[model samples]
Target: MTRTEELFLALRQQIVEGKIPHGHKISEPELANQFQVSRSTLRDALARLKSIGLLVSQPNVGYSVISLSTEHLMEIFYVREALEGMACRLAASNITQEQLQNLRDLLESHESSVQLKSGVAYIQEERDLDFHFVIVQASHNPMLIDLLCEKLYFLVRMYRYQFGMVSDRAKRAFFEHQHIVHALSVGDGELAEFLMRRHISASRDNVERNLLVNKGVIS
Candidate 1:
């Protein structure tokens, strides 16, 4: 990759991985020096990250990591419902035996977590995301995988980390993922799609009810 793309990925990873932290102002001079690039090049990289929703640019404050809101959660889950639902559907037929085994193993791991009663640790959200990500990649659709894995998951991780996950949500998600996996293992595409959509919708509703309070999206 070119220097610009390399810088872009470096900064994007820092933001998504929470190294930079959300809502923290990005210092161009510092970043440029760190990346060993000029300010103009760093600005170009920042612009690309902004376009992908990993960064937000303001008039006077310059750029910072995008902060989470209930509205952003709603929109992110909406996209996930549509894209990941399709991904599960496609994975039903396309998912291989090895992939099915992996899902089963993942389910068992989650069951262990539930048994230990540590579901509120926020680590489950990361593990939960890994499960969804495997299925999304199993869809065998390049564009869909890229959209869900590379872009949406970054925002999803950010929101999950910031808002936190309760035990109730974690338990529900574990069971939901199990059902979706079972459907896919049986080659029931329609059922997998339905279950995935319902799972994501429930998550969205929970966030809206508990965290958002009718704050709609900002343009």
Candidate 2:
């Protein structure tokens, strides 16, 4: 990767992992010096982060990391329910034999990971094999890929990392993934869409329940 691209990814990881805490103001000159990059290069990276909604720059205020909000997280889940559902439906039709095998392999590996973690939610290790991400790519729809994978996925990971979000339904989620994959393998677009939507809905419900009961985020 080029210097600017490298800087962009580095800053993005730090921000998403909360190394640079949410709502922390960024000083361009200081950040540039810290990273040993030029001001222009740093600005390029910051602008890319801003494009993804991770950072916001005001007229006089410069840039600050976006604060985590339960409401926004729920909003994203709703969008994922719709878009990823459609992607799953399209994937049932457009997916290649190789893609199908890749998905099956991914599930096997994910299953092993889940078992190793004692039913804990498996984190995406191979970026390409992130189950949902791979399914979306299988749709062969550039718009859907860009919206979900490029735009929203990182934000979801950010929330998970920052909140230490771990679902009690990890094993159940793995089963749901299996069902969705089966529907895709059989080229059942309707079933695939329904299963995908239901999976995302369940996840959103879990997050809402935890926010209310555990975090008391909702009154």
Candidate 3:
């Protein structure tokens, strides 16, 4: 990968995992030094992250981690529902046997990871993404895939932070994933779409519950 891409991934990882905390200001020079890249390369990386809404750049105050407000979370969910719902519909029509098998393999891997009680956040996160990305690619729509990629990075960050807030969320999510995959495997496009929409909508509900609990607005 390019130096700029490498820098962007590193910084994005840190921010998403909460290593860099919300509202924390990112030091350009420090980041440049840490990544062993020149300031210009770092700036390019920062700009990419900014475009994804992970970081906010100011005129003189530099860049800070973007804070997620309730409104922003709702917006993210709205876009995700539309984009991912469409992806599922397209994938149902276009998905080949090979792609379906690949998804099964990913699901098996995720199940094993969960059973083993692995605490590697990145691994879990990637496995979850692999499941969705396969469907997005199967859609055979370059425009849709591009848009999903842009939105995914930000969603990953937020989801990872809220990961632990819901009880057995991952376990439930795995089952929901299996339901969607089953529908796809049977060539049931409408069933697949319904399951996919419910999966995302349920996640939105869980996240809202998490936020309410965090704010002590819900018992």
Candidate 4:
């Protein structure tokens, strides 16, 4: 990879994994010195980060890592619930046998990972095992694909990474995924959509509940 690409990946990992604090102002000179890259190369990396929604730039304030709030998290999950529901609906009609097999393989791998991790969900770390991503790709809709895969998915991942989000519904989630896959395999668009929406809604509810408890809003 080129210098810019290398720097971009390094920064992306740190930011996504929460190694860099949320809303931390990025110091261009400090980053350049630390990474041993030139100003132009560092700017290129910063620009790439901005493109991915991990960093925000202002006219004079420079760049800061994107800070996610509870409101923002709920909004994102709401959008994902609707869009990904449609994606699953369409995928039931458009998904090919190969895609179906790929999803099954992913679930199998995830099952193994869950077992190895003592039942902790492994979805946060592994990109290839991203169940929602794989389903969205099967939808075969360009706009939906771009919106979810290209736009919102990273932010969702960022939330998970920063919060150390692990679903309490791990076993239930596995079964739900299986049911959704079966719905797609049978070309049951309505069932697939319903199941997907419910699945995502459950996740949103879980997060909200956890947040409320964390803040002592509910005991």
The C-alpha stretches of model 4 lying farther than 4 A from their native spots are 114-124, 216-219
Task: Report lDDT per candidate.
Answer: 0.80, 0.88, 0.75, 0.86
Give candidate 1's root-mean-square deviation (CA, Å). 3.9
Q: Candidate 3 — which residues are off by over 4 angstroms? A: 114-123, 127-129, 162-166, 216-219
Candidate 2 lDDT by residue in tens digits, 1-219: 889999999999999899998889999988999999999999999998998888989999999998888898899899999999999999999999999999999988877774436865656653587899999999999999988888787887788787674668788888899999999999999999999999999999988888888775432
Clashing pairs in 2: none
TM-score of each: 0.80, 0.94, 0.83, 0.91
Model 4 worst lDDT window (10 residues)? 119-128
Relative to the true structure, candidate 4 reaches a TM of 0.91
- Arrange candidates by lDDT, descending: 2, 4, 1, 3
| lDDT string, candidate 1, 1-219, tens digits | 888999997887788767898778999989988879998889999998887788888898899888766666787889899999999999999998988898888777667774435656324445334788889878888999878877677778766655654535767777788899989989999999999999999978877776545354221
Clashes of 4: 0
Candidates 1 and 4 compared by TM-score, better number: 4
Instruction: Give candidate 1's total backbone clashes.
Output: 0
The Cα RMSD of model 3 versus the native structure comes to 3.6
Candidate 3 lDDT over residue span 132-160, tens digit each: 77788887888888777665655555555
The global Cα lDDT (0 to 1) of model 1 is 0.80
For this target, which candidate reaches the highest TM-score against the unseen true structure?
2
Question: TM-score order of candidates, best first?
Answer: 2, 4, 3, 1
Model 4 scores what on Cα lDDT? 0.86
> All predictions: root-mean-square deviation over Cα?
3.9, 1.8, 3.6, 2.6
